[model samples]
Target: MKTFKVVVTDWEFENLQYEEAVLQDKRIELVKAQCRTEEEMIKVCRDADALINQYAPISKKVIDALENCKVITRYGVGVNTIDLEAAAYKGICVANVPDYCMDEVADHALALLLSWTRKVTLANAYIKEDKWDFKVTRPIYRLRGRTLGLVGFGKIPQSLAEKVKPLGLEVIAYDPYCPKETADEFGVLLVSLEALCEQADIISVHTPLTEGTKGMISKAQFDVMKEEALIINTSRGPVIDEEALIEALQNKKIAGAALDVVEEEPIRSDHPFLEMENVILTPHAAWYSEEAEKEMRSKAAMGVADVLLHQQYPKYLVNKEVKETTRLNESLDQERYALLTK
Candidate 1:
């Protein structure tokens, strides 16, 4: 039997048994590491046949140092942490678990939206302070007859729209990539980014971070929003300009902001958002659930296993150009030929 070694880089999860079980029958040996730097990763993953990475920077330097590494599978959807161009240049297949956390993130965005809209946390804080007056937190709006604008119409936003439909919300979205027909099918109005900014009562951002989308929501967009409008972001933090968000919040250009992610992680103690009563912040944990976590870990490892043992490409391949040209595919071809001759 042909054997392969799989290395997992920098996972914070408490368990690896799920990943182990998925690759148990594939004659694969699993090794785990808490690599936080390129040097550390290069040292431990030099001889690896494949890698499953979570939040570790897999740079070109790390990819170039791989002696025989074939695939690098990310534990989540966004591959910004992994150097896709470097991996592709080195003929290493890059894969990710794309659909694993759609529900979790959507649910998280909804929870944040509700928390801000209903002033749940604010009420709790007031009660803790021995203030028992509903008048302190005024202007709690009813959910019905509100316009919910989604910045991106990807899976998570789509799921969120579906989940919140029962709340009697009028959902509209601005996604240049999504067809108007698709929005119509879901009973969502397709609008321009400017229109979404100006018209939405609640704006929820779900776009991925890319050059074109980074800082897409800045001072200009905030200027157009309603004075009492609420904004929620479960997507990457950099998609919204943190500085502009701060300015808008301070100026009351918007009613409140809720975020599961920020432009910078583990926000500093001095961060302004921490002091704002109208703002709600959570650790970047929008894409989390016990089931989703397990699926992400297992599916990432399975992608490596599929490449190494089954000679098949991962369904969620990030670098599609590497399918035939990758060194991993070449190695698989060689293995298939050897087995056939035997």
Candidate 2:
């Protein structure tokens, strides 16, 4: 029997107890590191058979330094931090925990939207200052009868639509990847991105950050939205141009924006978003809940353990192109190899 070493490149959670419990095995050993940079990651990952990463960059240089790494698993849905092309070229499988925080993110998006709509933060501040006038936070509108435009109708946005249904919001979504039948099933109107921008009373962005979607919601899109429309983004930060969003807010092109993620995380202290009273910021914590966090950790560790112990493919393989060619899968029996390839 072969023993394997799995290194967690980085994790910000309070503990790795859930991961340790799931990955505990006589044949497997786990090492935890707080690698924040590529140099740190390359140094510690040299001897790892597998890596579970969170908020650490696994670049080409880091991948090249891995002596015998068979897999790299991300703790969240997006693999933007990892160099997928590099891992695929090196025949290393990549996996992610895609569904772990579906409900939490949707709930958070709605929470931010409500906070913005009801002026809860403004009210809290006014009261703290001993102001009792309702006019201090003026022009609050009823949520019902407002059109909710969803930029991406993936699982999280779909769940958001469901949650907002009881509030009487009309849901319209723009997702080239989602089929019309799927939109019909969700009872959401599928529309062109242009139409959604011009028509929606509130825009919630749930798209991932990709080459095509990096600046999808910039000045032109914002220009078309209603003057008082609220924008909520719980997705990647760069999806909406931060500079453009700041300018829009400064000019009052839109009512306000509630952001749980930013284009540049750990936003610099001097960033203009900090001074905007109309803007609500969360520490990129939309995908958080005690239950969700534990599930994400356990599932991410189990993805590595599945490939190593049970000879099963991961449930959410990111680099499917490397399945048949990976060193780990190739080392299995013909039957196991066939299963892994599938």
Top model number, TM-score: 2
Candidate 1 regions exceeding 4 Å error are: 327-342
lDDT of 2 by residue, 215-291 (tens): 99999988988999899999999999888999999999998999999988888899998998889999999999888
- Sliding window of 10 residues with minimal summed lDDT for model 2: 332-341
Badly placed stretches (over 4 Å) of model 2 are 327-342
Candidate 1, residues 1-342, lDDT tens digits: the string is 877889988888777887787778757988989999999998899999999998888988888899998888998888888888888887788999888899999999999988889899899899999999988789899999999999999888999999999999999999999988889888999999999999999999999888899999999999999999999999889999999999999999999999999888878899999999999989998898877877787778778877887777765778988865753333333353223212
Angstrom error at residue 162, model 1: 1.3
CA RMSD per model (angstroms): 5.0, 4.1
Candidate 1 is scored at a TM of 0.92
Per-candidate TM-score against the hidden true structure: 0.92, 0.94
Alpha carbon lDDT of residue 204, candidate 2? 97
- lDDT for 320 (candidate 2): 85
